[model samples]
Target: MWYRLGQWMLRVILRVYHRAEVQGLDRVPRQGPFLLVGNHISYLDPFYIAAQLPQRISFMAKAESFSHPFTQWFLRKVDAFPVRREEADVRAMRSALARLRNDQVVGLFPEGRRREAEPPTELKGGASYLALRAQVPVIPVWIEGTDRALPRKGRWIRPAKVRIYFGEPIQKIPAGKNREDQERIHQMIMSAFRQLAEQKVAE
Candidate 1:
């Protein structure tokens, strides 16, 4: 299948070129229906995570990425679904929730968009909302050196070291809470990611 081949190629490429180092992979739950939240720095973020993760992860990508026919085909094959970034894309949200309900892994970039620098900015609340709605665990992943591998708006790809760190999943959220409670969950996810990023920086 295309997805399998793509994952294989990614693994080989990362190993050969970047000397990719993945830590705490064992922290990721074997059985999902969980949210995989990570910092986004490059176009390769999703692929790198997918290649290293044992399960097939579905991404909520910006709608524009799906505009081209070939791109759409490839994205869908790799388990990415489009989301309208400027508005609440209810259909995409529902699709993501459905994937979670089916015990699948949903990859989300809480920042909502890729950043050009290391130590990404504040995260949006969508990932938290989805995790709360689905009553699933949130896995925090921190990726390093992706910006250097393929810098923002840069066409060239260079051999750059990349490291992925997976923190333990966040498992607390009260059922049927108010909006404030939801916001707290969002903060918790963001905090976990921030801590992971700081750790990477220290290294």
Candidate 2:
């Protein structure tokens, strides 16, 4: 109920303020558990994506955000759970796995933390790890113009046109050595995101 209400309110606000555009939603699979991975630009990336999508997505929030009572409460209201980013967070992984097993869509920022680097140099292996383990498809999402609207340090949000592109899912990972395999999946996802971003620019 909270997720639904939040989505409704956010949709109204994003439409009115950002004039956000969404494309390739039809590329998303209609059913079953899938991993939705996106490039992290602004803090609004996850929320913006969530508001635009019809179904619920379980986003991984940073664990520190849960330390404060109000933030934890608010995060819970929106159906987000915390993940420790410093090292391997067993609890968060367990939570994500459980959700995936239940046929739920899990959203992740493969770059690990929020970053603005184009063609990111290094990407954390969580998305690849989860997708390979869960044996589900990975849907690559590309979001644009969010940095201009709300940046990492900006206190005030300026109205900026935003666009999101959803690409087809990558179903199978090449079988090989573990490290090499994860790296392959990581590159593929990042490449897909760059493609979507490039496509958006051409339009």
Candidate 3:
């Protein structure tokens, strides 16, 4: 399958070129449906996480990415689905819920877009909604140096050192919360990545 092939290639390429240093990988749940929330600094973030993770990841990507045939094919091969980033994508939400019910790991970027800024300026509600609705554990990940390898508005692949820190599941979000409560939870998720960045993590 395309997903398997992509994963294999990614593992090799990342290990050989980037010299990726991953910490707290065991924090990821070995089984069952869980959410991987992190800062999206570059296009390579998802692939980087996929390579380091032990299980298959059903990644949630932007809908516009599927507009082209080649892109669509590549994404499909890697078990990734597109979600419209501009508005509330109910269909994508339903699709994500379905995958969660099927007990697959789903990766989402709460920041919505690839941001080079530390502690992303804004966070989206989709991640919080899915986490509460599915009653699944949410693991906060902090990825550094991907933006240098592949910037949002830059081209040309460059070799760079990358590190990913997978923090333990954040129990800040709960069921049956109001809008204000939702925003608080979203901010909490964002803060986790920033907090991790400040910590002295062992490689």
Candidate 4:
């Protein structure tokens, strides 16, 4: 399958060129449904994360990335689904929930889009909402050096060292669907993300 191929190829390429280093991969649950949350700084962040993991991650990607026919085909092959970044995409949310219910890993970038700023200026509640709805563990991941390897507008992927950190799974989202519950869950996810980022910075 293309997903397997992509994963294998990415692993080889990242190891050879970027010298990618992964930490705390064992922190990931060996099986079952979970939400994978991470900072998005490059277009290749999803692939980079996937290459180091033992399981498939159905990442929610921005809709624009699917505009081209070839890209659409390839993204579908890799099990990625599109999400409209401008508004609340009910269809997308339902699809994500369906995947989670099927005991699949769903990856999300709570910041919504690729950002260059450290400590995202804003975080979306979709990940937290999905976590609450599905009652799945949330794994916070942090990727470093992808911005330089394949920058926002760069054509070539220049060689650069990349590192990935996976934090402990967060499983204690407060039980409820209220706005307060969502905010608390959102903060919990972001706080874990910040801790991972801070660890990378401390190195």
Best-fitting candidate, measured by TM-score? 4
TM-score to true structure, per model: 0.95, 0.92, 0.90, 0.97
Which candidate order results from sorting by lDDT in descending order? Answer: 4, 1, 2, 3
Tell me which residue pairs clash in candidate 3.
none
- Model 4 regions more than 4 Å off: none
Candidate 3 residue-wise lDDT, 59-152, digit = tens: 9999999999999998988889999999999999999989998998899998888876476767889988888778777899999889898876
Tell me how candidate 3 scores on lDDT.
0.84
Error of 3 at 34 (Å): 0.4
Count of clashes, each model: 0, 0, 0, 0
Q: How close is candidate 2 to the true structure, as a TM-score?
A: 0.92
- lDDT tens digits by residue: candidate 2, 102-189: 9999998978888873656677888888877777789999888889998888998889888888997898766554878877887888
166 Cα displacement, candidate 2 (Å): 0.8
The worst-scoring run of ten residues by lDDT in candidate 1 lies at 116-125
Question: How would you order the candidates by TM-score, starting with the best?
Answer: 4, 1, 2, 3
RMSD of 1: 1.3
Give the lowest summed-lDDT range of ten residues in model 4. Answer: 116-125
Best candidate (score: lDDT): 4
Better of 1 and 2 by lDDT: 1
Q: Candidate 2, overall lDDT?
A: 0.85
> Cα RMSD (Å) per model?
1.3, 1.8, 2.1, 1.0
